[model samples]
Target chain A: MNRTLALVLYGIGLALISHFAIVFAAPYLATDVVIARIDKVRALTPNELRVAPPTSPPRDLVPMGNADTITASSWLDLRQGPLLFEAPLPRRGEYWSVSIFAHDSDTDFIMSDRDVQAGEPARVLIYGPGQVPPIQSDAIIARVSTERAFLLVRAIMRDRNDNADVEALSAELRQATLRPAP
Target chain B: MGKVFRWVATTVVALALGAGSAAALINFGGAFDARIVNGAWETGRHTGSASADPYSRARGAIYGLWGLPPSEVVYYTALQDDTGQPLQRSCSYQVSGGALPARWWSVTLYRDYFLIENPARRYSWSSTTIDVAPAGNWRIDVNAAGEGDNALPMGERDGVFALSLRLYQPLPQVLDNRATIELPAIHRGACQGSSS
Candidate 1:
């Protein structure tokens, strides 16, 4: 009922709004940069797929994408597909390796994980050559001219460290491939 | 009278909200604290002797779950604690007990989640080439660009480095009991205001 009281109430409302505004607006105000997917998700190298080394590992490894990022077989080939890629599904406790490659100007950036979840059993992304440059050489991966894509592969609980099991990957449909544009 | 109630209610609500906000903003232990070092949140018992406010501990744990993968992992974001202490950055410290990973381990530093190209032309260190104390337990220094140049390196994060400890296929001895394995403090190098 008093003017003084009304003014105080108004001030409180203003303060609340100001605080909320700052908290929510920050993300929008800040520019969000995109991370590129550098390497193609391939099979495993023979060495990486091997289960027992002369030196056995002491414990089970939550295998990250050091090997499966590429195909172990030299003759294997993958191409850019529709925006989505269709890969093998992973069984329970299994996850696919995923990498986010971002190239800023000349610098090449890489983020890879063996655990890109294929839990849903279908559909993943394969950023095409335009999105990811092509493979120039062993050391350099170029942006393929064909449109790249993303795919979801079926992940299996099979032991990644066991090299013997990986041989099956080449034969079975368990592994998914991204193809170059038709 | 009606206006008075309205104002009183508004003031009470405002103060309450302010108090809540302050509590969230309040940070407990500085970066070196084990629980908070993983992130802004606190951590569970890591078999260490350190004091940290409970609130900070909980917050740091939540952050760790999100940023950290499963088990204990590290990152080097340039953020400060309540007392304005440098906690995490692209640079960090990692130590191991009893044969650090016979299968290749590295303390890799990254600017963001992605590794950065540095003038040092180096991205990480492994069991080999990495200089350590003869006892096997060792410590390495990390900083953003030049950290020791000033006051605890607590200012802007520009041109700074962030570090992460990566143990690739860690051997059993180090993995099973990493918490007990002592980690040396991340020191500021050759800076005027840093703790050296």
Candidate 2:
């Protein structure tokens, strides 16, 4: 083969290898930011929702957050065992959603207030890979593929005058608990 | 020895160029290309889904969005006015539209991916809160000075800003034919100083 042709092939081969490597690694690297934010909250209190301060400019941790609602987040480490998730049911006429994201940023599951059966507080059992949960009555069971995951909870805020109500909802969410299954 | 050195050098350069270019393309390319443009507003129909390509996934990661699938929520963003001019903080703009077909929706102002802080501590307006005209239309003023009722305070930041319109639980037709949806129009208004 000609020297130039050999060099071209070598370069192309290397480029292809690096391209795939980056694509596969990007999700892990991108997830690092979320992990760090979760760690910060976990440092304050483990296995509980840490409500972010109402939307303000220049907050480094949470990006693209909606100002129209109050947001709270929590990190779950399922290595120990299955964890019980519990939150207060939103008041009537209010919209709330709970979204769980896998380590790769995929939306594993989402449950809205509308999805909850009437008269049931938001409660679920999150199971990690290869873990089985004890039978529980009247609780949602979600099996997650990753050992680490995150949850984003949002509740509607009506207007500026509704700051107090929003704060109340935030406090209610912060009361949410994630504990090892019995 | 010389041939081995040449191969190693080429491999290093090629890997660097390849990874760097791929990252740039994922970050800077038209990653949000599943767009439906209605005047100045543009929304990606398939932004946060398993179907999204690697580039879109990378962009969503950078923005810290664990994007909901289009069936749950649709996000429309605009960085320009109806005239195709960039939205500047130095100038004011008006967003006017009627009700959207969704269970709920909101319009938010952001500068550089973060909420624009103001004295009122207000950064967005939702359907339930915004005042509607007798004819069922609504108007919102986007100004740096926070003037007028229903004003979205743009703050004093001197740079381009963006508007994100979020529709939660949109109707089936709106999601199926997002390209032809009638989103709010952003019209350029008075200016305090020269626009950048």
Candidate 3:
């Protein structure tokens, strides 16, 4: 091939490869930024829940957040071992959910208020990839492919003006914990 | 030696151009394409799932991380009003709707991907927060100052904004038929100045 034609073809091939590589890597890269930001801002150790304060100029890591909801987050480090997830549920009419995301931003599992019994708290056991759970346990068991995952707890408020209710709920969500599995 | 130097330069330029173009496309082209269009709102079927295509996953990570799968919560975002005009912070809009087919739902306004700051500190209205009018209808005012009984603040910033409608535990009808689902209609009202 001529010199100019050969260079053009080489450039085209290299460009296509570069484009695909970036696109494939973007999700993992973006998710890493979020996990790092939350860790830095919250100064949280793995499995410790911190209910994000609903202040103006919201301080949460992600955008398009629901300010009306009291959200608590924890970085689940399954490298240590399987962890037990526990949280209080809201009333029947109110809304609440626990969403677990993989390192690549995939929704590994989500257990909402509707899943649990009306008055019972959520009890879930999360293990890492290829890890096994107890053969007999009341807690809902799930497995994630990544060693590090994210757990989000959402508690929706019925009335925005209810300050006392908000604070009380925030306190309860802050009590949501993840401990080493028994 | 001259030919070798020219080849190296071409390779570097080609890689740079490719990477830069990819970044621009993902950043500029928002997450949802034409997959599921409910009026102005749009959503993808595999959003927040591992099965999502590379483009969808990349865009979702930047636009909305920690989003639940559609089986748990279907998220719909609107960048424009029903009239095809981009939603701007300078304009007031009336978001009117009736009961949605979901156990719980919320409509929130986000400017530049974050909740707009305002004195009221109000940013959204959900199924429980909104007061039902006669015939189960409700209306929310999305304005700059973020005032009113049902107000979704867009803050004082001058720029375009987007609305996120989240339906958690959607009814079978909504999940089975997303394209024809009835979501709130965003009707643009008065504009503050020359800004459209």
Residue runs of model 3 more than 4 Å from their true location after superposition: A2-6, A91-93, B24-34, B147-149, B193-196
Candidate 1 lDDT tens digits, B22-109: 3454233223444423332123323111132333333332222112221323222333332334545443332233354434444544
**Can you tell me the DockQ of model 1?**
0.05
Instruction: Give the winner by TM-score.
Output: 3
Backbone clash pairs for candidate 2 read none
Tens digit of per-residue lDDT, candidate 3, span B135-181:
99999998887766598877766765999999988887787788898
Give model 3's docking category: medium
TM-score per model over all chains? 0.35, 0.88, 0.91
Best by DockQ: 3
- In angstroms, the error of model 2 at B161 is 1.7
lDDT of 2: 0.76
| Candidates ranked, most accurate by DockQ first | 3, 2, 1
Segments in model 2 whose C-alpha atoms lie over 4 Å from true places? A1-6, A37-46, A132-137, B1-9, B28-33, B192-196
C-alpha DockQ of every model: 0.05, 0.56, 0.68
Global lDDT scores for all candidate models: 0.34, 0.76, 0.82
Alpha carbon lDDT at B141, candidate 3 = 92
After TM-score superposition, the amount by which residue B24's alpha carbon in candidate 1 deviates from its true location, in angstroms, is 9.2
Docking class of 2: medium
Interface RMSD of candidate 3, in Å, is 1.8
Model 2, residue B45: what's the lDDT?
A: 49
Q: After superposition, how far is residue A141 of candidate 1 from its true place, in Å?
A: 29
